[model samples]
Target: MPEFNEKAMHQFNQGLIKEFRENGGKAVSGPFVNAPLLLLTTTGAKSGKPFTTPLVYTKDGDRIVIIASKGGFPTNPAWFHNLKAHPTTTIELGKEKFQAKATITKDPERQRLFDAQAKVMPTFNDYQKATTRQIPVIVLERI
Candidate 1:
């Protein structure tokens, strides 16, 4: 396995975010092609600036679910911290955009949602094993 490069990952994320926004939230090519993805805009934890991240998501009965897997990195993704500092955020799924509140799922519910998403993208299971810290499963409830 290769070492995780935060700088490279940030650049890649920026490219995907630009593509997703330009193409009406659809990624024309790249790893997320044909995958269910969303653009989450959250306030920076410390900077108070808006930061948008393109993430794979799974729908859960009127809510959007995302994982803080960070590609199995030891630390949770920055967006997760941003959401923690500012729970109210925005999400764009395809051409639809909506306001949402982020909440971290707990316990068995987290595991259940994680499993549901893992079924769709099995790499999530691998992500959990790659890191010791429990990855958070966050629900974006439409506001």
Candidate 2:
């Protein structure tokens, strides 16, 4: 497989973000097409600036569940750390955007939410197998 390119990934994410917004939360191109996608806007941990990331998500009750897999990277994604620093964030789903509180799951709930998402997108299972760290499962509840 090709090596990860941070600059390229950022550019691609920008494109995806544009497409998602243009289509009212639907990604018309790339791997996320037809997938459940959301835009998570978190405050940067160190910079204290807003950063928006497009992520795949699953619903748990009225909460939104997301995985910090980062394609099974050894460390958690930047957004995860951002959330740790600032739990209140913004979520853009479908055509609606709202404020939400981010919470990291624990124990059986974490495993269960991970399993539920893996059932929807098997890549999460592979992501878990590829990393040593326990990938974090986060829930976003409307605030």
Candidate 3:
């Protein structure tokens, strides 16, 4: 894995976000190709400004699930906190965009969903083992 630097990751994510938007939510190249991804726009907790994050997601019935793994960093991602403060947000999946409400999943269900996602993207398992803190799993229910 590459070195984990916040600044570098931010720049990289900016590039991915741009590509995702320009390509109708599809990542034309890079590791994200053939991978499930969505643009989640949230209200910043402190800044109160709108922030958008590119995330890999899985669908469960009518809900979309995202993990706050932060690539197994010690702390949760800012987007996670943002959504916690303002549960209502917007999600862009493929060519479709819609509003949704975010909720943190509880235990049992959280673990189950995490395992299901790990099965699809094995790197998630490695991410879990990389950090001491238990990553959070968030569900986005369309409004």
Top lDDT: which candidate number? 2
Give stretches of model 1 more than 4 Å off: none
State how far residue 51 of model 2 sits from its true place (Å).
Answer: 0.3
What's each prediction's TM-score? 0.96, 0.97, 0.95
What are the lDDT figures for the candidates, one per model? 0.93, 0.95, 0.92
RMSD (CA, angstroms), candidate 3: 1.4
Worst 10 residues of 1 by lDDT: 1-10
Give lDDT tens digits, candidate 2, residues 42-132.
Answer: 9999999999999999999999999999898787889999999999999999999999999999989999999999999999999899889
Model 3 agreement with the true structure over 13-115: per-residue lDDT tens digits: 8999999989999998999998999999999999999988899998888889999999987889999999989999999999899999999999999999999
Candidate 1 lDDT at 111 equals 94
Model 2 — which ten-residue stretch has the worst lDDT? 1-10
**Which portions of model 3 miss their true places by more than 4 Å?**
1-3
Number of the candidate with higher TM-score, 2 or 3: 2
Q: Choose the strongest candidate by TM-score.
A: 2
lDDT of 3: 0.92
